[model samples]
Target chain A: MKEIVVISGKGGTGKTSVMGSFSYLGKSDLVIADCDVDAADLHMLLGPDYQRSEDYYSGELAILDQDKCINCGACLSVCQFDGIQSENGTFRIEAMNCEGCGYCQRVCPTNAIQMETQKVGEWYTSSSKVGSTMVHAKLGVGAENSGRLVAQVKNEARRHAKKEGKEIILIDGSPGIGCAVNSALSGADYVVFVTEPSVSGIHDLKRVTELVKGFSIRSGCIINKCDLNSQMLDELITFMADAGIEHIASIPYDETFTAAMLEGKTLVEYDKGPASQVLIKSWEKIKQFAETEGCLK
Target chain B: MKIAIASGKGGTGKTTLATSLSSHLSETQDVVLVDLDVEEPNSRLFIRGDQTHSQSICKQVPEWTGDCSLCGQCQEICNFNAVIKVGTQIMLFPELCHSCRACSELCPESALPLKPRKIGMLNQIQAGNLIFVESRLEIGEQQAVPLISQTKDYIDNHFDESYIIIYDSPPGTSCPVIEASKDADFVILVTEPTPFGLYDLKLAVEVMRKMKKDFGVVVNRDGLGNNDVLDYCDMETIPVLARISNDRRIAELYAAGELIFSTIPEFKEQLLLLERSLELSTVVDPV
Candidate 1:
């Protein structure tokens, strides 16, 4: 299956909106993966009915065995994270504050502090109204293993695509070029960069583009809300050309995008406006490029 | 006073406001600016100063020695699979290692040794009366939280009694942001008047509430959208510290690498008001 991952260097750049519109256009043949585990909002727009969920455990957190006799301060001194605390002559572990480093478990003289695998988050496989399998997750609050959760979500999407004989796997990647984004782009066939037309937008675009190129993944750019700054749009186009990146489409500023979001609909479903038309055309071009590159086997 | 300027969303004027406020405050009083956004630090662009000191921040990862007896205990104990043993040869991926030291401490054969790997750099610079300390993670490197923790250590060790330290934190309420905001006297949440902004601001507030840190909001691009942010803050009883209008000049100045308070004299007065307001509030222990 051909996989296209849409990512924005910065947040709130219409990455999800563009992905939602693309989902509407390619409703039948695609599997949607929301790799933005830090704040997964694709479910809100796609309105997926979650079917199956599995707990994702990657790191070990300190668990105190209160049955142990002596209350020693040995674990507290070695814990650099300040995860261990003493109160009322008893020792306790704050899971949220723990980095799961196991230093406390190591330093505990009595072996009372045992390392236990804790569920940091959960990944879900769901069915969206668009007839596409939606794979997403919710990172536990104060959780540290987002990269692992992202990988799980992508793997589930890949498995679903192979099982259902889906033609495409479209991923809504996380913002920023962190571990989560790296996991999303590891095996992707194509990457679409959705960026805004602002100074910081251009700045982050360059950063994330460098990251995307580091993986040797072919990428195209789509400047969302390009009318917000015409000068910036021209600069972005020039930059894309200089960087040997193709400009897929320019989506202008539209209130209908927000209106659609408020109504729990994609832009294509809410309004058949120019923005929706541009997104549809962009989706077609992406499909053509993927097929030309033999990504859609 | 130690104040942390943070935003729930990236590019929401955290660095911009922190640098502007630092430059303004430095004119009259001693101010130290700490850029704790180790993942993507850009504060050095705004504050050009000669480096006074630099240090390396490292985290401990397990290094397998040739003395391994192929017991497989390290592999079994590793929850992250950072340690893998195949055919009596043990391998470790440092990037995947959380540095929990579980493998090293649990290995009975003493095959795994805790090795410190430099993941980032901490730099201290002096710009007039203000001191700028910035933590920058190495390219393609993980572990921003450790660098932030070390930066906080540097701040504690080198903080001057007469200087006001303003911390410019990373976006999001993750480990790195929590590390930056820890032990701060006050936190200033910078946001814009948009749906996404509101969504993220609430998340940041939730984090602050969990941390029990006192905070207020500063709405950037105030007049661009309707007063939904103001209304939300009012309804929630969260104070709106300042509302900066949609100022093109300020934006241009920021893009041009010019300090806003220096270019726009009026912002200096506004920043002074913010300083005074923060000073009047009682300080609380961040812990």
Candidate 2:
């Protein structure tokens, strides 16, 4: 199945809104995957009825046995991270500070420390109101290894797509150039970047675009809030042209986008406004691009 | 006093408030504004300053130098599987490595030794009374927490207790945001008035409460969003720091990378009140 992932370098640029509309349009033909495991919001918009869930464990955490403790301060000395704590001659591990390197476990002569895998998060498969299967995950607050959780969600979506013989996978990626975004971009057929015309938006777009170039994946750009600043819009257009990124559609700034979100509906599902029309046009272009053979080659 | 401006949702005016508040406070206090959103550091675009100093930062990761006896102990102890032992060689994956040094230190053959790998850079800029420090992670690097920790360490080493520090933290309630605000004296949570904003703001508030941080809420684009955010804050007993109205001029200035205080009188007045309140909150008792 072909994969179309939507991401915005800067947050609040309507990435989820665009993805929600795309999911509504591609409901019958695609499976939805929300790879923003750190703060997954696609499930909120899709109203997914979760059917299956599995606990996901990625990295290990150190566990100390106080009974076998010989307060030599050996584990604390060998730890690169400040994970070990000592108070009143008792030692404990700080879960937030631990990197799970297993160095402390090795240094303990009393065999008091052992590495145990942690269930950091969970991934789920659900059927949404739009009559499509959605794969998403929830990372525990302040948990590490979000990139792994994203990978797990994407894999599950791809597996379900293969099993159901779906034609496409529409992914909603996280906002940043970090590990989560990187994992979401891997092995994607096409990427759609939703961006705005603000200075921070343009700045972050350039940074994230540089990252996408490394993957050598075909990408299209959708300019949301195109009418906010004419000068910045011109500059954005010039940059996109120079970067050889396809300009999909220019969506005007409209409150209807948020209004639709407030009502727990996609823009296309809520209203047939100008913004919705532009989004529909953008989806058509994306569909044509995804179906085109030799596009990746 | 150290303040962090953060939001769970992106583009919620963290950098906008960080840059403007730092510039205004610099008029009477020594201020250091840090851009801890290393993945996408945009504070540099808004805060123009003279280049004072810059340096490349590196993290220590294990590398094989062909000195192994095929002991395979390095691969066994690595928790992240960043190191792997092949038939006649050991392979290293820098992207997967957390720089935990478990593999290198546990190797009995001494083949796996820690080496410095470039991950990102830190640039310091001086703007009048404010010293702006921005850290940018190199492309393809996965970890942002280590660089953020190092940048905060740099600030702690260079600046004394007198300087008021402001951090423009990353968006999201994950590891990066947690690292950015873990040591702040006060946190300013920025949010919009829409459902998405309120939803993400609730997650951020939960994080702050779990961390036991003293924080207030700042409502950007107040007229654009509904009153749910204010009502939620009232019910939670969270102070409303300031409300920036939804204005085209503000958007225009932000698009042009201009400061809001210099041209917007209403915003300036709101920031002044915020500054006074922050001063009263951060005052230390005399010995």
Candidate 3:
């Protein structure tokens, strides 16, 4: 099966909007995966009713038992993260602060410290209204294992695709060049970069393009809000040319996107305005590229 | 005192606040701005500087010396897939190594040894009185937290009591963010007034609380949305240090690669007020 990941260097670049529209244009033979575990919003437009979910654990967290506690303060002194705090006469561990370094457990004189696996997030497999399986997740507040959760979400999506005999897996990747983004890009056949026409936006696009190039992956670019700055738009085109990236399509500034988002609908479902039409044309080009590149069987 | 400006959400005006505050504070104090947003750092755009020094940051990866005895213990302990055993020979992918030393530390035959590999670059630039430092992780490098840690080492080596350090951290409350904001005396979280902004600001606040650091909020583009951020501060008893209005001129200047505080003189006074308030709060609160 082919995997096409849509990613943006920075947030609020209409990545989810474009990915949502792509899901609409792509047939039922596609499986959708939302790899933005930290702040997932694609499910809002996909409207997935969760079928099953499993907790994701990454590492161990130390828990201190108050019953066997001795107020020696040795654990606090040796703790590198300052995770142990004295409250009211007992020592406690802040789950978010604990890095699970095991220094506290070792320094504990009473043997009251125990290491336990932490549930940092949950991965879900659901059925979307678009007749496709949606794989997504929610990283618990102050969670430390979003990268692992993203991997799990992608793995589950691939499993669903294999079982359902789907040909393509469209993934909505996260915003930054962090571990989660890496996980989303790894082993993907094609990558689509959704970016804006601003100074910082162009700068971040270059950075993410460099990251994509590192994996020796084929990538294309789509300029969202291409009308925001004509000069920057020209510059982006030049950059794409220099980087040997295929210029997919340029989407104009339109309020239909925001309106569709507020209504929790993709632009194709909400309105067939100029922006939506532009997205459809963009998808057509992407389809051709995927076919020519042997991404779709 | 060193303060790091950060937000869990991107496009929250972290670079604006950090550069503007440094410009205002540079009039009296020697200020240094360190851009820890290695992924997409933009502090150098606002403050122009000449390169003073540069160095490549490297991490130690394990190398198999073909000393026979291909025990499968290295594969079992490495959770990062950095080492994979292919028949009798073990293959190592250096880019995927987190430098946790689990493989080498647990090797029974001592077949694996640590070797240094460059993963990122660090540069120190001088913009008049402000010393700006930035790190760029090499492409395909999976370890950013270690680069951030090494960047902090640069700060530690060049730190002076005469200058106040300001760090512009990367977005999101992950390991890199934690490494940047680990030992700061104070943290300033920049946020907008939107619902998404408030949601991410709350997550950043939770991280700060967990780190046991004193922090406050700076609402950028305050009038763009409702006063929910103000209400949140009121409810949580956290202080709203400053509220910057939505100004098109400021945005235009930022787009033009101009410093907002230099263009808008009033923001300098607000930054001074913020500095004074932070000073007083730190003095009043016991360390």
**Per-prediction backbone clash count:** 1, 0, 0
Off by over 4 Å in 2: A293-297, B280-287
The TM-score values for the models, in the order shown, are 0.87, 0.97, 0.84
For model 2, report DockQ: 0.74
Candidate 1 chain B has its poorest 10 consecutive residues by lDDT at B277-286
The CA-based lDDT of model 3 is what? 0.80
- How big an interface RMSD has model 1? 3.2
Window of ten residues with lowest summed lDDT in model 3 chain B: B278-287
Which pairs clash in model 3? none
Please report the TM-score between candidate 1 and the true structure: 0.87
Model 2, B24-120: lDDT tens digits are 8888778999999999999998887799999999999988999769888888888777888899989999988988887877777778888999999
Instruction: Give the candidate number with the greatest lDDT.
Output: 2
Fraction of true contacts reproduced, model 1? 0.15
State the displacement of the C-alpha of residue B182, model 2, in Å, after optimal TM-score superposition.
1.1
lDDT digits (tens) for residues A1-297 of candidate 1: 888899987666789889998988899699999998775767768888989988888677788898872787888777767798889978888766787767677667788888788776788899998999999987765567677788889989999999999989999987766677888988998889898776667877787777777777777888887777667778889989987677899987676886687667898999888998898899999887666562211
DockQ of 3: 0.26
Model 2 error, position A176 (Å): 1.0
Off by over 4 Å in 3: A24-29, A62-115, A129-131, A252-273, A294-297, B105-108, B225-230, B265-287
Better of 1 and 3 by TM-score: 1
| Predicted complex 1: CAPRI docking category | acceptable
Better of 1 and 2 by lDDT: 2
